[model samples]
Target: MSAPAREVRDVARAALAWASGRRADFALGEDALAADGQVDRSWKPLGELAQVCATVTRHTPPGDPLHARAADLLAFAWRQTGEGELFLRLQRLEPFATYPLEVYAALAAAGFRHPAYEAATATVARTRGWRLTEQEPTRRLGVLHAEERGGIHRDEPREPALRRTWLGGLPEPWTFERSAGYALTHVVFHLTDWGRAAGGVPGDLTDYLAHWLPPWIDTCLDARMWDLACELLAVAASVPGLPGDTVPDDAWARVAAAQDASGALPEEGDAGDPAAYFAHHYHSTLMAAFAAALTAGQGVPV
Candidate 1:
């Protein structure tokens, strides 16, 4: 069966309505300054809207019409959420078909796609911008995640690798692949890095990853980010001796052996193929729990 042609207009409208109200707290009025001088409720609306965009983007299938529209929405919301890196990253990832229809409708209906959106996303090299460089190598490495180039030598600069780096020390370009290769390598690399930094042991890797992941995740309202977090967690479990992995099968049973000893099981019916699951559904829920746990000084089981 074929995919829908995308209710490109509808998605664009949704994105706009969600984004339009984000600045009131940061507006010129009294609300902008909470006397405490911190950016107040301004962040809440923006964070909520960014999650909505991420939710839509996570559920929409790649190559679907709405998918591209959602990507543009993802871009806009990321700006509102103050995560310009994710905004530009997602903008660069927005497929071509979603642009003409989605962006056009948004431009027609809503002045311009957010003032900050344009400024931040203006320079992404789309298909129109793909350029062949003559200053480099002879070998071709096929496709890339966030860069315009197709090939890289073994000794190539690590800058491109750094662009997609985010939560749990995994890079988006690598993590987005959702493969055993990406998962295993990603966890191992981070574990190794964390372990090495902690005098070549696992003593404090959890603290570092836990401490570093949330802020790096920025507005963890997006569902995709949450799903990514789960995958990372699962990857951690798969490692030979992490808490979740090291614990025997009986340990989880024991953890759940007494109702009083265990917290409620994650509101049921979440099991599925982790790689194939829609990122939007599980991302926010996962992050919310993760955040709540962090606030209460808890940790994921490996």
Candidate 2:
């Protein structure tokens, strides 16, 4: 590698290492760290270490609520502030949920941009949990409304009108748990896109290839069993009966490069399919080649 390329890679490595160390410390639980440090067990450590980890993870953007919370929670966890362990624990209960958002915030601070921001927003719509309205043909209730208080209903065989309201009560805790995994994956996808752009465009694909692409491909797989979803979505959009081709060739190229000929993706033509030679195959192949031409090692082309 050239001096500049080596330098960039080294810097990225250092940042990742620092971030990973902070994450590990937080995972160990701040109190445990302090107790081990022998600071006196008479008082709770109040998780000062945890807060520092959070701040480092997010890079502490100015005026962010999370930033403020991290600070307060750190103080409380360490017993430096009035807040207690109960409150601090409650506040940071969903670091996974916060993680994705923090990644985006970090990217912004580092000057990364993404063309898929809108596409990502569409994916989040699935998380909103809406009732399926519209008449049902049989006994299945056609309309699904948020549970009503003491709502009286007759079990009917035919389609019913649909309605939806807010899900009430303390809210199912698992709802957040289930959603966090999916949400984090989505967030990671966006970051991967940004990384790909950064690494490929300006002349540095190494970071993306070594650090980002593997999990990035996994993210796509998490979204769908096969690359077919994106391909299908594209085909649907491209044809009259479908959504109509909205995503540009550049976007398609990124997706294609993530795949391989064997369908396992991440490598060159590993799978063979004569049918793919047509629209699906050609699209992926063409876009990937174009991406390759832009300048390997740099990142996404402008």
Cα lDDT listed for each candidate = 0.31, 0.28
Poorest stretch of ten by lDDT in candidate 2? 141-150
* TM-score for predicted model 2 compared with the true structure: 0.18
Best by TM-score: 1
**Residue 110 error for model 1, in Å?**
14
Count steric clashes of candidate 2.
Answer: 30
Q: What is the per-residue lDDT of model 1 for residues 177-237, given as tens digits with 9 covering 90 to 100?
A: 3343233323333333211112222334344434433332322213323334433433343
Instruction: State the displacement of the C-alpha of residue 21, model 2, in Å, after optimal TM-score superposition.
Output: 25
Per-residue alpha-carbon lDDT of model 2 for 93-179, expressed as tens digits?
422122222222322222333324323422432343422323222111211110110021333322122111111112233343323
In model 1, state the lDDT of residue 216: 27
TM-score of each: 0.23, 0.18
TM-score of 1: 0.23
For every candidate, C-alpha RMSD to the true structure in Å: 17.1, 22.7
Each prediction's number of clashing residue pairs: 2, 30
Best by lDDT: 1
> Which parts of model 2 have CA positions greater than 4 angstroms off?
1-58, 80-302
Q: Counting only residues 3 or more apart in sequence or on different chains, how many pairs clash (N, Cα, C under 3 Å) in candidate 1? A: 2
